[model samples]
Target: MEILLWIIIIGLFITSFVALFFPVLPSVFAIWGGFIIYHFFLNSGELTTFFWISMVTLTAVLLLADVFTGSLAVKQFGGSKLGGRVAAISVIIGAFVYPPFGILALPFIAVIIVEYWQQEDFLSALRAAIGTLIGFLSGRLAEGIIQLIMIGWFFLIIWS
Candidate 1:
């Protein structure tokens, strides 16, 4: 029974890893969940309570990093709510239409085109788009790093 549970946990970990690339899924968090649950309930290990505390804290940071990143960037670029929402939707749609690059480029391209259309000013629209992209990229990069840390924590906890 314990072995079966471990197998289930491992499967979730792999699924979450795929979410890392797939945008639509919350893969990193899933991986975090697998490690956290296993370490707390099943894995015969040391510092179980402290480990969970650190895991929970790290998970909070990981989630927040993803959420605030794009908006912060958009704000820096002087993008409005309308522009940000539109850009965000475009990114999701782009994920289906393209892939990783599609996910990444949709914001930069979509915001530029839309903002330009709305304001009829090339330079201003360009600024907003650039800001949106920069913020998004930074956040995405941070998310990747957080995911890495979480995954590392998972493995180290499991192995130890």
Candidate 2:
């Protein structure tokens, strides 16, 4: 039973990392799931209140980072609000379309099409698309780092 519980916790942690690229997965929740499992099943009150509070704060930061990075990047490149929305939607859709590669390609293509349609300029559309790609990648990188920190913090608390 102990081994099984550990496996489940570890799996959840791994899933959180996977969620970095696959927008379909709830990355933060998956991470919380691991901590919750450990708190309830394995250690029972082992996690400190400070730990929980910190985790919650980090979660909020992670979410904000994701939204801001994408929107800011798009806007910085002259992409409109509509382009940002389209890029976000494309990310989710891309998750199901062709997987890993789709996640990258779909947003780039979607942003270009939407921006071009709205701006009526190919060069401007391409710029926005490139911005979307950069933003998406930046957001993912931030998310991955945060998730890693969360997991590392959990381990440090538990093991030490």
Candidate 3:
């Protein structure tokens, strides 16, 4: 049973890490869930207070990264506040409307439309759209790297 539990926990962490790329998956929650599984099943009462705090902090930081990066990217690329806001909003709506790809497509379309509406220039709008794409990709990369670090830390905790 102990071996089985450890296997499950590891599997969950791997799934959580891979899920970071998919907008629809709550990858942060998956990592947290793996921690909970460890605390309850594999080593009850073994996790330290510091571990809990670190877990929460990691989750919060990743969540903020996901929420802010797109807007920052849009603005960095000369997109207006309205364009950035639309891009961010479209991502959420896109997740519900399509799923993985929609999350990317809807934001690009929305940002371009809003940028063009504001600037009335096709090239400028396209640039902003590209920025939004870069922002979204960067956000995913950041989350994936953080998730790997967090999982590595978890393994260290368990093995050490």
List model 2 lDDT by residue over 56-144, tens digit each.
Answer: 99999999999989989999999999999999999999999999889889999999999999989999999999999989999999999
The segments of candidate 3 whose C-alpha lies over 4 angstroms from its true place after superposition are 96-99
Candidates 1 and 2, the one with greater TM-score: 2
User: So what's the TM-score on candidate 1?
Assistant: 0.79
Which candidate do you rate higher for lDDT, 2 or 3? 2
User: Which scores greater on lDDT, model 1 or model 3?
Assistant: 3
Rank order (by lDDT, best first): 2, 3, 1
lDDT (0 to 1) per candidate: 0.75, 0.92, 0.84
TM-scores across all candidates? Answer: 0.79, 0.98, 0.88
TM-score sort, best first: 2, 3, 1
In terms of TM-score, the best-performing candidate is: 2
Q: Please give the range of 10 consecutive residues that has the lowest summed lDDT in model 2.
A: 37-46
Clashes of each: 0, 0, 0
